[model samples]
Target: MTAPATSSGIPVSRIDPYTDASILDPYHDYRALRDAGPVVRLDQYDLWAVARYDEVYEALHDHEAFLSGEGVGITEQLNKAQHGSSLTSDPPYHDTVRGLVSRHLTPKALREFHTYIQDWADRLVDELVERGEFDAVTDFGQAFPLALVPDLLGWPVDEGRERLLDWAAAGFNAFGPLNDRTRAGFPLLAEMGAFLHRMSVPGNLRPGSWGAELVADAQAGKIADELLPALLGDFLAPSMDTSVSALSSMLWLLGSHPGQWELLRQDHGLISNAFNEIVRLESPLRGFTRLLARDRSLGGADLAAGSRVLLLYGSANRDERHWKSPAEFDITRSNAAEHLGFGHGIHGCVGQALSRLEGHSLLNALLSKVRRIEVGEPVWRLHNTIRGIESLPVVLRA
Candidate 1:
């Protein structure tokens, strides 16, 4: 990492964060970016990238400076079209929509499904462990959410569930600039959005589920009726890939580090912290773009208004300056909760409570039944805006 070029020139790096190569394994480039400077101009994308923990955390909180309303993705078209989605909105409007969502995901609401997710994990793991070997991502990572989220949100359980995974992947993929990957994902995303929109209809939703609640709110004038579809669409797009990515990464980490698993086994209380540690170590979202609403300075880098900066959450989590032995995964890592795995500030993940509940239930269930976790080579799933294992093979011993 080099220092800033001069008072006139910002430190420039030609690394393309969206390229398949970088997305496959960004830690190397992330270290390079961090070492280069607090803020480095990505010449390829013509965007500023902040890799250090302090700066990224600050940017997430200072939304007025690093605005999300312009779009959080690399593409102009999708961002413009997604203006209605809460992910692309600013405060006031963002607060209203987020508040509506919070009503359904409060601790009490999320706690109701804890037993279900736990039992689901137990049943799924039992069958997989009996087989002696299985692809963790396909069998568990993808399956768990597909089985659970739709039911909770009132989407038809069987219909289009497979496409939901693809849609979730494409949602993040489309976040990047219009590249080969972005272009490739358009059709699937369009289709999935439409399907989810249909699922938002009051008649289509389960009588007492969250999706129905959104409709009820609309009818009661809580939120606009037209925004109902976008609200429901939000539940699927962000939740699926992120949750799947985190869950698979947890299994991989525990399997690879048996000593950590033993520690987790000794005390189930550590399950929550262990989940936080897993996500902190292997963040599902590589980063998201934030457009500068006005001329501002970030980490000493001066930027004009209407500039885009990539807040590298994944890199920030492993920043050496922030965490001791940042690369090592420890279940008992006290500061693990400080990691920006779920991000921070107002735009932070709204589905996080549900995600944690699912993680806790599944991880606790595994600790109780499985004695040893033998993991094989993991197939990587690369996307411009998300990082996760696509196929993780594991053999759980009783």
Candidate 2:
């Protein structure tokens, strides 16, 4: 692998994952990486970054060329060692666990939850509207998803929402590094693990909820009992961060952009399209490393085998090559789904339909109540990986 040198002729700084400035505000770093050439090696992390739009898209589409089982997480060594999580696995075995996951998460199954999603959204909006002021993150973002996911997954409703929230936080935290990101994540992960362990036992998930159905799937020789913990853990771990953060990002954009907010406020019919536009502008995950399957040419760069590659979804969405005026956040972008926020290919997000449902439900409810999401100064949560707001205060305009 060629040593990575920045445009300034200095090698990139690979420091403790938590403190690396490039990882902090990666947009600038993405510009440098993408322009430095197709596959610039990062001397710091010793990883190759594919910051250009075309390369990341090609890599995702040609999984046979890039290969995911090696791990989508940063470390090449870790990617190689991974077994059977839907987020990491590639094919064959990946399809098995993913198929089991799909049995309950299918579009029909997802639609089954729309009434529940809208109910939660409406109830929360009603409560917050009555007060006329609320913390968007805690009062609504965290509450709505936390309220619905456990019930939908068939976890016992008792303190499950709080537990699920903690676990989900830790799970995303673990994705970044071993410092505050990974270390602070243990308790939430443990709580989620314990809760999921109980859920995995006999008679937990409702006979229909996928989590419960997994137990039956296990009995029917579909999924092994040993993998049930990880399967359920995947739910608590990956489900909330994107949904919560994505919704937070949407609120931040619509509230901050009065025109955009009013467009939705006017029609309410554009809720789904507006949600897609928001995600296109500000995706939740920044970029993470992937290992190259073999030495190959990608997006005008020579990508070598065994080198770690950075898949910069956030940066790529803004690439000028594919998007006309990519940086513009027009809610009217014709093909908002063209953005890689949900990713592409087999390893792409499986829960995207549910994520969309949450957005649709939330937006529909918000349009009914808020004439506009009055903006307050926003606070960003700095995860090494997830791009999201931690707290966004809003004034509800009825």
**lDDT, each prediction:** 0.84, 0.72
RMSD of each: 1.7, 3.2
Over 259-306, each residue of candidate 2 has an lDDT whose tens digit, in order, gives 888877777768777888888778877755566788877765666698
Off by over 4 Å in 1: 1-7
* TM-score for each model: 0.96, 0.90
TM-score: which candidate is best? 1
**Candidate 1 per-residue C-alpha lDDT over 58-144 given as tens digits, one digit per residue, 9 for 90 to 100:** 999998888888889876778887766677889888989888876766678777667777888889878988898888788878888
Q: How many backbone clashes does every candidate have? A: 1, 3
Give the lDDT of residue 41 in candidate 1.
81
